[model samples]
Target chain A: GQQVMQIPQYQHVQEGEDFTTYCNSSTTLSNIQWYKQRPGGHPVFLIQLVKSGEVKKQKRLTFQFGEAKKNSSLHITATQTTDVGTYFCAGPLKSGYALNFGKGTSLLVTP
Target chain B: EAEVAQSPRYKITEKSQAVAFWCDPISGHATLYWYRQILGQGPELLVQFQDESVVDDSQLPKDRFSAERLKGVDSTLKIQPAELGDSAMYLCASSFGEDSVYGYTFGSGTRLTVV
Candidate 1:
């Protein structure tokens, strides 16, 4: 069974602070996807990374896939109140049907 | 921007009662999935359907839970004789394709509480 683990189960920061969440997998993954869930809301797709050592950015958010494709990271620069939510990373195992999701990093940005 | 739709955003029932939730994915989407999210936890896949056929249901509690996507469109998830531990948010999502890269569009989810 494949499993994904995320570090820093919870993080709280003041506005204008930076936050980062790390995700690691027990098995190599073909691709990794990131999602964000607002408080009391369903998860929303953010981005996906396929290539090893790949890096992608959306505004102040930066995503990185490890060179081995077994880990990933999501970093937010100058967090805002709107960035408050749980961030999750998911990747497919060999089967490729259902994705294995990390426990998620809950971020809290205080103004 | 089409999004997945789910009904009965919240439900409260006594133990041993039967409960059902409905989900309608974005039109033209080929894959649908049902996930459960306990409080303070991430969503866990319960079942996945490729159109009208189930592709995976290993995590589903088949003894008490069942799901169907008949007609390759809307779907339903039912839990019979629900227990107190069944309290959680049931989420439905759909993807344009089965690939992980395509990601999924998720519905608001149904929060169930079995008292």
Candidate 2:
């Protein structure tokens, strides 16, 4: 079975500090998608990385896919209070239409 | 923008009672999924449906749980004889395609608590 593992189960940082979460998969993935869920909300899609060694950015958030397609990272520059949420990385299973999600990294930004 | 829809945002029932939740996926999406998220945990896939046909349900507790996506548009998940451990958030998500590049849109989940 394929599994995605996320590092730093929890993180707390000042509003002006930067934060990063890493996701590693047991096997190479075809693609990876990132999502964010507020404290009591449904998960929302953020971004997806399909190409190996690819990088994408959305304002202060940066996402990267490793060349081997087995890991990914999300980095937030100068975190904000609105950035408080759980970040998840999901990958499709080899034989199904569903996805396997990482445990997620819960981010807490303090002002 | 289109969004997935779910009903009964919250539910509370006693143990051994039957409960159900409903979900309506975005139009034109081909894949629908049901996930369960325990408190402080990631969403775990319970079932996957490609239109009206179920693709996978290995993680679902078949002895007590069942799901259906009839007509390929709306879905329902039911639990019979629910236990306290069944308390969690049930999320429904839909994607346009099978590829991970096509991200899914999830509906506000149904939080269930079996007392």
Candidate 3:
């Protein structure tokens, strides 16, 4: 019933270039979480945003939640080869047990 | 660091065969979830369990997919008459809480290839 869509399905950049991925949901979410999955690896938790228009930063990465709670974005400044992976944004399911994940934005950084 | 445990990191089965995957969540974690990720998509929920009780399984294909957490400590997912479309990575994740506030700790996942 609910859907989350991610923009820029794929991206490739130089080692020092910046990258951004956007996620939009069909329904308003109470909270949103970000995850990263390396090639041949499982999804790893990155960050979570709850408040309206909230922004959280971890090292070189920044996560932002839209004011309406229907969208979110992740930005990386000066990406590196190690930053190559698929980034997914997940919203809490209304029933409150599982998360609805966006398709994901795959980032490839070249040297 | 504690991590979720999954068995048989990979599986290859013939179409119309049966396959199963196992998972053991971190100690003391009450919530467990099963998700499937295709080649280029994010993980999608298949089922969720809370201490041996199923909280939801609406996305699971009941006709061919079944999951159980009998003791609430470990779980198993079975697919009968697996089809080519069932090829994907099956992920098992756990959280200390029932909601996303704590986020999830995912296992390496079982990559299935149906021939």
Candidate 4:
């Protein structure tokens, strides 16, 4: 069975600070996707990285995929209060179509 | 901005009672997934469906949990004789394909509380 691990289980940052969460997998992944779950809200789709060593950006956020497709990272520049949520990285299982999600990094932004 | 629809946003039941949750995915989506999320943890895949057939359910607790998508449009997840350990959030999501890299549309999950 494949497993995904995430770093910094919990992060509390001041407003306007930077935050980063890293994800590593026990096996190579075909693709990696990021999701955000607001307090008491369902998880929402954020982005996906497919190509090896690919990097994508969304405004103040950036996502990078490792060259080997075994890891990924999400970085938020100048985070704001609205960025408070748990960020999760999910990868598809090697034997099946279902996804295996890492224990998410809960981001808390202080006012 | 289509969304997956879920019913009974919250449920509280005693142990050993049967409980069920429903999900209706966006139209034309070919794949559906059921995930369980415990407090302070990420969502874990319980099962997945491709149209009317199940693609994966290896992690599903078959002894207590069962899911069905009889027509491939809507889904139901049922817990028979539920237990306190079953208290968690059950999420439903849909994608355009089995391996959709574009991400998925998730329904507002059903929060179950077993006492």
The A-chain TM-scores of all the candidates are 0.96, 0.96, 0.96, 0.96
For every prediction, compared with the true complex, DockQ reads 0.70, 0.71, 0.75, 0.72
Best by DockQ: 3
Worst 10 residues of 2 chain A by lDDT: A90-99
CAPRI tier for the interface of model 4: medium
Per-residue lDDT, model 2, residue A50, is: 87
Candidate 1 residues A8-107, lDDT tens each? 8999999999999999998888899999999999899999999999999999999999999999999999999999999999887656487777889999
- The Cα local distance difference test for each model comes to 0.92, 0.92, 0.93, 0.92
Model 4, range B1-115, lDDT digits (tens) per residue?
8999998899999999999999999999989999999998888889999999999898899999999999999999999999999999999999997557668889999999999
Q: Candidate 1 vs candidate 2: which has greater DockQ? A: 2
Model 3, position A66, has a per-residue lDDT of: 97
Pairs of colliding residues, candidate 4: none
Off by over 4 Å in 4: none
Q: Tens-digit lDDT track for model 4 on A1-111?
A: 338999999999999999999999988999999999999999898998999999999999999999999999999999999999999999986745877889899999999
Root-mean-square deviation of Cα positions for candidate 2 versus the true structure, in angstroms: 1.2
In the range B46-96, model 1's lDDT, one tens digit per residue, is 999999999999999999999999899999999998999999999999997
Residue pairs of candidate 1 with colliding backbone atoms: none
Q: Could you give me the TM-score of model 3 versus the true structure?
A: 0.97
For each predicted model, how many residue pairs clash, with residues at least 3 apart or on different chains?
0, 0, 0, 0
lDDT of 3 by residue, A57-76 (tens): 99999999999999999999
Write model 2 residue lDDT over B1-115, tens digit each, in one string.
8999998999999999999999999999989999999988889999999999999899999999999988999999999989999999999999987674659999999999999
Kindly report the TM-score of the first chain in candidate 3: 0.96
Q: Write the per-residue lDDT of candidate 3 for residues B11-105, one digit (tens) a residue.
A: 99999999999999999999999999999988899999999999899999999999999999999999999999999999999998655566999
